[model samples]
Target chain A: MAVKYYFYPLWLRFWHWLNAVLCILLILTGLSMQYSNPDFPFMRFDLAVSIHNITGILLTASYLIFLVGNMITGNGRYYHLNLRTISTELMKQFKYYTLGLFRGEKPPFPINEKRKFNPLQKISYAVVMYVFIPLLIITGWALLFPEITIHDVFGVSGLHLTDLLHLIIGFFVSVFLIVHIYFSTIGATPLSHFKAMFNGWHKTHD
Target chain B: MMIKGMRIQALIWMFFFMIANAGLFAQQTDSIPENVKENQKCLKCHGNKYYSYYNDWVEGDVRERMNPFYVIDSAEYYNSNHKTFTCIDCHSYEYEEFPHPGYLRMEPSYSCMDCHGFGDEWAKFNFEEIQSEYEKSIHSQKHNETFSCWMCHNPHEYKISARTEENIKEVIAYDNAICLNCHADIDEFMFIAERENPNVLETHDWLPNQALHFKSVRCIECHAEQSDTLLVAHNILPKEKAVKKCVECHSDNSLLMASLYRYQAKEERNKAGFFNSALLGEYYVVGANRNYYLNLISIVLFGLVVLGIGVHIVLRIINK
Candidate 1:
């Protein structure tokens, strides 16, 4: 038997889709800038730059919305990292993905009202949202006002360093997106997790 | 990895080759070329101050004024930096008789580019682009008949001026002197323009503390091409196209960088074609240059993120 649970809330689903679209747009435009080859066109360089800057601003606003919504709705608990159980839970999740997943064993910890994410999802989401996203936004703003943000930190040039950091973080975000997509396919059915994200109900084995 | 290593090695070899060639070329400029040595006969007359006297009368409305001809001071000529060159070196016209037929008005004036082209040994110093730029200049287009290199540079006394760290003020004075020769005096400026226009000071009245700007910056810094390069392109822009934006020179990636902070590596002049924060430290250009420590932290954090992800992937696969 299977039971349907309201795992994803309305605002969370909206934020998820909005964040995904913005990330995809940013990555495409960012890649175009990084390579800077006219022959390999994602779009015209100037157009891409304008769109990228505008999307980055919108993404920052959306991120703030996510943060505020999480606080007000009490859904932030799902993302809170419990350091004691994290290691053990992470190992169990890792084993399930590699071996037990193929053996058709049940999920070690199922999603409910209190626990919205599996252990691995919780940690990855926290890092991506709390750490990487903020870094990207800060670096993006620095790049926008290069005259103000640039300085000599040690002997190295500050603007050069900012460019380098932006590139590195962009790479990580790109990799994370790939991993996230792949992990989304690991539910009961390949489309089940995606459907749950689109609506609010997720089916769990009993 | 192998390809990348080979590319690095190639760059290193190329760098060394450039350094070696630059040193060898620097030593060769000490001696004058053979062409200047062959024109002694023409030099004997023209090099003498007494030989420069002219009998032409000035047609003045008030009783025809007898303006005595000014002579080319041979003593000054000999002491000049270009003393190795003869009169015919620049004249380049036939003069077989005692009273040369084309002496007063030489048929063909030698263009400065005649010896400055790529084939010349001196062209290795990278002045070829300057010729190309000068041809496209508004000055060249508008005053082709009136404009000649001698107007600014005395061909007989031209010497290379060094622009070092300590002598920047000297360099600015020296460079601006060429522009000021005609520009500073109203009579000379009007004579060169060959028409009546508002004087330079009056034209630049829109700028605040315009005299200070004139003192600190070269005219060409704003009047020439707005390139990232430090090299002053010879394309003298028209007043309409001249840089009017105050922020263009004052902000980061300033136009002054190219005019003032020229490429340190003369050989790699093209390499440092764009703005670099490393090149901008002595003079702070706000917003263009950034802090290096924050950059390092960002890089390290990014690396850790990648490592963590890699480890997790490895662990997951290992459990299988």
Candidate 2:
């Protein structure tokens, strides 16, 4: 058996980990503020607010960096949404997860330099990266700006609709996490996919 | 003969004295002629003569009259419950002449303790103590100058129904005005704070105005109740409890609560580990009080991170 070489560049790995950690922190503090029960007083309300704002700014900056880096590195090609290929790829990935993977088969698609994500992953990541995350950042920043004014952001005066949109997008991210976990388990072994992410190599019977 | 003569003389003298006294008594009675007639003459101008004495004389015509002293209603004395009793019944003193009301005239006033004989018990009511404490309160200093014992506990209408929603709203509005009157600066400050921290959603434009903030929320909104079991009090709550209280209104599409929650959540999370899932989730369902769907997203994010790391580590060990 030889190991397949699907290199995740050092910058990509760095950004991925940083984004993951920061997003987790944001979500945790965010939830605390939302529920605000006595038991969850990880931070005082005022301090949590400052931290959430700072972290949000950091996340937005990092996301921009990632975007620019991808474009510069020519890795942005991986994000293209080709409908014909994506539709077929998504169907095949679904079948593998639902039936084939359970029957001790390999994944229908393989990770390579050109195609980093399976069809489902590509579509989901595109939505999260281009659509949802950007919307969240804009709304979150607009919320921060007293000058921008909530009315200016959404043609309204209060944060109700804005909060709802933020939460709804957050929900999508959570669903993505669950499916991501399940797929990780479907690797060559329960832990193999996780290992590949770190070492940038996967074992395959040639 | 001398003793007998002395006795007869004494008896004759006693008899004469008795007759003379009787005649004098009758003449005196006739001359007085029951001054009730004179009192009736005075009553002609005094409306509702019987209740006149009970009227709030301090605020009544007596205080308003240009003439400091005018007895327009003597009927109050004649037709009162003490009608058979003279003015001296309660006064216990008589006016010898006009303009000289008397050296020590009792004021027409009574307390519940006076008639009920609860003087001893009334002393233990500790009203003075409560009044002193209230006088020192921010509400007292900011609002009413004459914040007496009767201000909150109206002596005439001392009922707890003052806690009703309508009454409370009125009180809150009044109390808020007190703050505004003194601290106009707070309104602008809050406006800036709200604008700066609009939350992740960009829905609203400005924070609620000073009037809306005070009336809609109170000091207790952020400061928890003294008693843990009390859900709400004086419209304030402990910060944690306040957040929970907001759920009653903000959750489930409640615009106010939702906006407040988002702003708060972001703010709180920024400060410290106030809402770290690893810490708070074990105590209770993290999302039960939250937007459940959003919580799910958080969980998923967490799971993905875990999976990514787990797969990476395993593969590394195997390859090595």
Off by over 4 Å in 2: A1-3, A39-47, A146-157, A201-206, B1-177, B183-320
* lDDT, candidate 2, B26-87, per-residue tens: 88877753545444433333323232322354655332222323233343344333354333
Steric clashes per prediction: 14, 39
How would you class the docking of model 1?
A: incorrect
DockQ for all models, in order?
A: 0.03, 0.04
Q: Write the per-residue lDDT of candidate 1 for residues A35-84, one digit (tens) a residue.
A: 44433444665566678888999999989988999999887888999998
lDDT of the candidates, in the order given: 0.68, 0.52
Q: Please compute the TM-score of chain B alone for each predicted structure, in the order given.
A: 0.57, 0.27
> Per-residue lDDT tens digits of candidate 2, residues A1-206?
44676556678777877887778777766766665544435565445556778889999989998899899988788888988677788899888755565465666777655667778888888988899889888777755652343432343334444555676676567556556766666555778767877776764423
lDDT of 1 at B237: 92
Give lDDT: candidate 2, residue B241: 46
Chain A, candidate 1, TM-score of 0.95
Clash count in backbone of candidate 1: 14
